[model samples]
Structures are given as structure tokens and as C-alpha cells.
Target: LQQVQPQGEDVISGNVSLPKVNVRGVVSNLLRQRETKQGPERVGQTDSDVINLVSMLFDFILDDDNLPVPVKALLGRLQIPYLKLAIQDYSFFSRGGHPARKLLNELARAGIGLNEDADHLKKDMVFKKIQSTAQRILTEYEKEAVLFDELLHDFSQFMQTEVRRSQMIEQRTKAAEEGKAKAQLAEKTALETVRQRLDGKTVPEVVVRLLTDGWMGVLKLVFLKYGPESNNWLGAVKTIDHLLLSVAPTEDDAARKKLFNIVPILLKNLRQGLNSVSFNPF
Candidate 1:
């Protein structure tokens, strides 16, 4: 079998243009040349209809905009082979489950969403696979139809693995986005809590800086780990209130005694909170 070289064509603005020629005449000439060597065979009305239908199918495949230009070109190489198949087997038209028909469908589907401007066309896995498949059929196929089934099975497995990998990447991206949103909310809640407590209260510059910068981070961390209603969150908030009261000017004897009593515990709690966030007290 002489390898049918792909006809010349040009692609412009995502459309392909082939030299004007009669498709039926081309098919007839190809069959005539083959018959010359293999002995003359009568061309009947059914063979003519099959040739015309295969030509139309090729025309549709070429004109399809969804397929990339390179993909369309690769598929065009199969025209002569497909024409021969359809003429020999009438079931190529009637049987939708034909291996050759399914292989064609899989090739087109695989090429969908591939960018036309991709660099190094030969390096692309899908394009390479399609190119290899078309070349194998062109050079190796004679009367064996099982070749189509073998190619289809291998291609389907590759595509299935690719689909699973893409799904996993997509899921990880979604999870990262959700985690970012949750952290942002937690930070906002932490800021508002600190601001409300310090509002209308005269506190030392050191205390103000500590709560806004270091303690606020601790609150955000606690909120993220144990939620707003957790005992850990309530205890952290209470520590902030006690720290403020300890800094206030108190002349009452009872109040001063109480402040002194709680001062050691307040310092201990503050040290632990700051350490949780890796904040240095010094």
C-alpha cells in the first residue's frame, strides 16, 4: 500500500483552505490505481455512494472550528484510508459502534481546548499521540481493522489518567482559596475585638503597641484553632481586659491589693500568649 501523502493546504484566521478539486474524482482515481495492480474490480452504485459520504465526512472534519489547525491537518491524512475502509465495509456507515468511527471521535475530542499557539508542537503529548496514531494507520494499516481498537484503548487510558490529574490539581486549588478566605475573616475579627476593648481607654504606648501588634495575632490564632465560642477564646479575651485594668491608676487599698495579687498571673498569661505566636516580649 502506497502511503497517501496529505494534500497541500493553508491555514488563515483559524480556517483551512485546500486547492479546488473534485473529491469523488480523487477517490475514483485512487481506487483505479489500486485496482490496476490488484486486478480490476467493478465500481457499483453502493461504492459510489460510500465514496461521496466519506468525502462529505472529511469535509465536515476539516471545516470544524473546534479542532485546532494542526489537528485538522493530521486527521486529513486519514482521508484515503477511511475512504477505502468505508467502500469495503458498508457497516462503517450503519454501525455507530465501529472501532474506526470511535477512534476518530476520540481523536477529535482529545484535541479540544488545545491552544493553536502552543510552543514546540511536537513536544505536546496529545499532538504527538495523534500524529503517531495517524502515521501508524497510514504506513501499517492494510485490511486489519483491529489496529483501530488497539490505538483507541491506549489513547483512552492516557486521557483518563490526564483527567484524574487535572481534577486533583483543581481540588487543591479550591481548598487553598477557601483557607485564605477563612484566615482573612479571622484576622478581621481579631482586629475589631482589639479595637473595641482599647476604645475610650487611656493606656500606655507600650500596652497599645503590644495589643495591636502581638496580642491581636494571638487572638486570631486562637479563633482559627478553637473558634470564637471556645473556652480558649474567652480566656484570651479576659486576659486582655485584666491587663488593661492592671495598668489603670488605683488609689483604693482593696483595689491596689487585688491588682497586686493578679499582677503575677497577668504577666504569666501574657508571656504564654506572646510565646504561642513567637512574639518576643523584649
Candidate 2:
């Protein structure tokens, strides 16, 4: 019994390699030991079939490359316990929703994304929880089937909470990325508009700086808040056009009068736009 008892700590800690023990042989030996104690008639054909099936199931689990190494090792430690359960309750094979079977499935699912590196394993909460559950089973499990039910309930709750937290983080990250992209696009649109308006125009360096820097930011803000088709965006664009018209040379008296009218409104709009983006207009 001592020799066949699972050495889970060694496997989990990576202190030693997983011993190459024969699953069928181990099951047979344990069964023989039990038979000696409970009378020779206890071992039978049904028990032999159970042993073979349990061994095959374990073989498949151990050989699966998809499962993380730590997960496989921990599950391997449960061979004796699972074999006992299968032999005790033949319904374990027939029932799809069996507590023991569900527990194993949940454990495997949780381990799918787990990092197998030793340093990461130490910090992995899921792996720690699985290790705790396996340790509890190894130490406390006997003939009680309710143990699996309780463990499954607790593990499922933990997993659900973790999944929700992960979803919230993912959503926030995606929103931030989307916002950054929209802001970049808006800035590009604003710069293009400023360049098109200023092309071949002889304006003072201060006015050029205002349009290229502060006014461009205002346009981006307007586009972001009200969109390109909105009245607010159109108003901002008109302000830029008026500023350019006011600054251009005009000799006609009527045109000079129009320029005088445009100057005050242009200055007012420029003040408001600069103020909106917190641009200093000294």
C-alpha cells in the first residue's frame, strides 16, 4: 500500500520525474491487497473490467499532449481513488453527469490555458486551487461520494468569478484601444483640413501656428464629439474659412467693410476654439 500510494508532491514540485509505473499492474496489486484483507472472494470479473477501463482512461489522460504537464501529473495521482470509485459504483460508467466525472472534466478545462513553467505554476491561482482540491481528495477521500460533489461546487464557483473578472478586463482594454484609434483618425483628418486651407496662402507665422496647432486640435475635438456630419463640425470649419478670408488682402471699400465685420467674429470663434482645447493664446 505504501509503495502504490501516490507521490503527488514530487510530481507537482518537479523534484523527481514521474515514475514509469504500470497502471494495470498497480490496480491489480491494490485489488489483491484488498482481497487478502476482505476475503479472497471479493475480487471478481466485474472488478477486473472496472480496473481495465480505469487504467485505459488514465492512460489516455497521461498521454494527452493538450493537457499541461502539471495537470497530467496531478490527475495521474488520482488513479487509485478513481479506480476505487469506479469499482464501488458501476453507475460511474453509465451516468454522464456523475459528480466524479464532472470534477475531472472541470479540472481539465481549467488547466487548458495554464502555464507549465515552474515559476508561473507557483503564481497560478487556478493551479493552486486544483492542487488544493487534489490534496484534499488524496488525504480525505474514502468511500464518500459526496466529497466530489462539494469540491465540484466550490471549484465551479471560483472559475465563474475568475471568468467574469477576465471579461471585464478584456472589455476595458478593447474600449481603450478603440478610443485611441478614433482619436488618431480624428487628428489626421484635422491636420489634412488645416493644410488644405493654408495651401498657397500668405499668413503671419502666428496665424499659421494657431491653425496648425491649436485650431487643428479644436477641429479634432469637434469631429470626435459631434462627428464630421454634425452642425458643430460644420461651424468649426466655417470659422477657419472666415479667419482665412479676414486675413487676405482686399482693396475694395465694401470688401474692407466685410473684413471689419468678419474680424470680430473670427477673433471670437478663435478664442472659443482655443479655450475648448486648453490651448494658450498669448
Candidate 3:
């Protein structure tokens, strides 16, 4: 067997000739773009800007580049409602900590495996539980009245696998790096590895997470669009926390306390006036 070396910016593989590549130029251009567009635009408080932001968020979710085919199809039934939810509060989707994007990205990234699991997973009891619960949440949202604790209870149950994954990551990190500094670096790498590898090994976990997270994203976008003036979703969410606190003397459910861990659920409706502009007119 004969091995061929690079021949003056060209490579020979049998009859095939590989072209020379400019790696540095590719990377430099990417960096330049990132420097210019690393964050969401600084949207103004103007009525128009609010409307524009809401419209943009709606488009972002449905655009071809934003979602993969299978995942999009799976949630297609809810897209219109989801967009309606977002326009009500665009601020929430813009932030992190919501599990919806993670679930969407995971399912989208799963490729053919997700489509294969669809029928089987939906048939699972856990999947049915999630579907029923999510539908209930949507109904409440439409009525403009949401039970904060109920949502969290469903969320906690659905996130059990994710919680276990977190614990596994922590245990693995602590096992390898007993020291603080090394532990941080190791945990970071481990998390990236875990996220990249995650997929629906079980039908129930996948369906539940997908429905829960998708709705969570929709619910969040509602606040981002409509609750900008309140400027404190946590404060709104804390009303529930305060109520639970008042009842803690007899409630006795320790897990209910975690409802305080939620981001605020603003009661304010989406701002009106579609003619308004969110971007700078000048």
C-alpha cells in the first residue's frame, strides 16, 4: 500500500483531489459575527417595540432554521397556542433556566430515534400523565389564571430523570476531583458530555420532558413580551410563595416549598396595540 502526502495545497486520494482549506479565515469570520451579535437586541419600552419583540419571538420558534422537522411536527399542534402564550410574555423565553429549550433541542437532535419512539412513548402511562397535566395547565393559562404549585408538581415529576442526571454528574465530578478548582472544571466538562449524549432511552421520560419543556418555553415567552414593565417576575411568583408560607404550618408538604424556586408568573396580560413598534424607528 502506498501513502500519499500533501501535494502543493492539494491532496490525492486515489483519483480524488482535496482542495486547500482556510481554517483561520473561517474561524475569524465566525468570531467577528459573534462579537456583533452575541445578545438579544436592547428592546425599548415603547408600545411598538413590545409588539415587534412579540412578533419576532413567534417567528423565531416556527422558522425553519429554529426547529428540526420531527420536533416541530411533534409540537405542531400546540404552535399557535404557544405563540399566543409568547406574545403575552416575551421576556421569559429570552432567559435561561427554563427546560423547554433543552427538551426541544434534545428531541430535535435525536433525529430518527424520536420518530421511532413517538407511538410507543405516547402510549406509556407516564406520557399520558404529562399530556393530561399539560392540557390542564393550558386551560388554566387561557382563563388567565394559573396554579403555580400545581405546575411545579408536574414539572418536578417530569424532571426526575434530569434531576438524577444532575446527581450522577455531581457524583462523578466529586469522585474524580475532590478539590474545589479541579471539581469545577471537571463538572463543566462532564455536563457538556452528558448533554451531548442525552436521548430517549426510555419512551416515557422523553415524551414527558418534551411536553413539559415545550409548554414551559411558551409560558415564559408570555412574560417576556407582556411583563416588561413589572420588571420582577420573581415578585409575582412570590405571591404564591408567600401564600404557601402562610399555610406551611399545616400544609406539611416539604416538596411544595420548591414552588418558590420558580421564576415569577406575572398576572399581567399581554400589552395591546399591534401597530406599536419595538425597534427604534429612527
Candidate 4:
């Protein structure tokens, strides 16, 4: 392995070097600038002026081209710890030559030196006021959160209820459609029997008996199942009314009267057969 050295003019070229005249020129220029700005008669300056002059010198050294080589080498070899110690020493000298006592005195004037109740009352009152204001704001916010939560909960419940209602309506509609389908099937069976009889084809005796008696039997079933209340009995009464309309004599009195007579007598005989459970002759 080989080590590569820096070859740039800024780092390796000896011609780009620091010189003694640059240091002297920078220091002298800083001193003259300070005197011109702050007045000529001030000789033994304060600690703040000394610090300013030192900072100005640091900037000038950084900018000068002909700085001293020894100074540049020393700055390059400086460690962070050594630089920090130098800064602390400078700061100690700046703070009235005694940083600890100056800091303590400032803290003391700011109420650190007070005994017992000397400052407690005012401090406690201010702290308590701040606490009370914070508590009031928290309570108001909590109440608002609770109100918002309640509103959200109510809306959720209302939506659920609407969903349930819609489902129930759908179920009822499906049940009604199924019931209509059953009734249509029963009507078709009855019509087929009637068609067979009119066409002079032999119908099973059981089917004829059922068609004649089943309408009255349905009326009786309705009455027995729902007779406890007047509203419940309304369906039975309606069935009886429709039965009378279907069998009643009409404007073709002669023909309709003959039909009414034949159907009623057939119904009387079928009623007896339907009353007997063991009379199935199909």
C-alpha cells in the first residue's frame, strides 16, 4: 500500500506561504481601525474592546496571504480540547476576571438569594393562575369531544335502524310475492279441473268435491283462526261476500238461476264428503 500526499497549491506549494509581515500588517491595521472608530485618546481599553480586537485579528489572520509560517503550522496542529481551554481562559478573563462570583451575584439579584416567604406568595399566585387557566381549557375541550362523540354515535344508530327497516320491508315483499305464487298455483289447479269437466272429460271425484267445498272450508278456517278480534274476522267476511257474488243469479236470470241451483246442491253434498276425513276416493 502507498500513501498519497496532498499536491494542490493551497496545501503543498511552499510559494503559497504565511509570512511575518502579514501578521504584523493585520495586527496594526486592526488596531488603527479600532482607534479610528472608538476615538484616539482611549489607551487602556475595557475587556469588551480587547475581545473585539482579538476577534478582528482572527478574521484578518484568516484573510492575510503573507502570514507567518510558524503561526500557520501551530494553528494546523491545534486540537479541539486545547482550543476549548483557551476559549474558557479568555472568557474567564473577560468576565470581570472572576466568572463564578459574577454569575452568582447576577443569580442572587434575580431572586435566587431570597429566603422562605420573601418571593413565594407572588410566585405561587402566578403559577396557580396559569394552572387554573390550563385546567379550564382542558375541561372545555373534553366536553366538546364528548358532544362530538355522542353525535357520531347517534348518527351510527340512526343509520343502523334505517338499514334494519329496509331489510324488513324487503323480507315482507318477498313473503307477499311467495304467497301470491301459491295462490296462483291453487287457482290454476281449480281452473284445470273446471276445464276438464266442461270438456266432457272424466275428472277425479275428489277434485270436483274439493272445488265445490274448499271455498267454504277456507272461510271456516279463517273464522276459526282469527275470530278473537273483529279486525281479524274481516278477512272471513270478505271471503263470504266474494263467494256470494260469484254464485249469485245475474241478468241472464234463467240460465244463472239454473247454474246457482246446481252449484248449491253440489256444494251441500261436497260439504258432507269434506267433513269426513276417510272419504278420499281419488
lDDT score at residue 65, model 3, on the 0-100 scale: 56
After superposing candidate 4, which stretches have Cα over 4 Å from the reference? 1-143, 201-269, 272-282
> In angstroms, how far off is 231's CA in candidate 3?
74
TM-score of each predicted structure versus truth: 0.78, 0.85, 0.28, 0.25
RMSD of each: 4.0, 3.1, 33.6, 32.0
> In model 2, how large is the Cα lDDT of residue 222?
97
Overall lDDT per candidate, in order of appearance: 0.80, 0.82, 0.38, 0.39
Candidate with the greatest TM-score versus the true structure: 2
Question: Which scores higher on lDDT, 2 or 3?
Answer: 2
lDDT of 2: 0.82
Off by over 4 Å in 1: 1-22, 33-38, 120-128, 252-265
Candidate 4 residue 168 Cα shift, in angstroms, is: 1.5
Return whichever of 1 and 2 wins on lDDT.
2
Put down candidate 1 lDDT per residue, 1-282, tens digits, no spaces: 332354222221234533233557656766787797997766778888887788788788778899888788778777877877887678999987898888888888888767776464545677778777877888877778888889889888888987898789899989999889889988999999999999999999999999998999999999999999999999999899989989999899999998889889899999999999999857
Ranking by TM-score: 2, 1, 3, 4
Using lDDT, rank the candidates from best to worst: 2, 1, 4, 3
Candidate that beats the other on TM-score, 2 or 3, i.e. the better one: 2
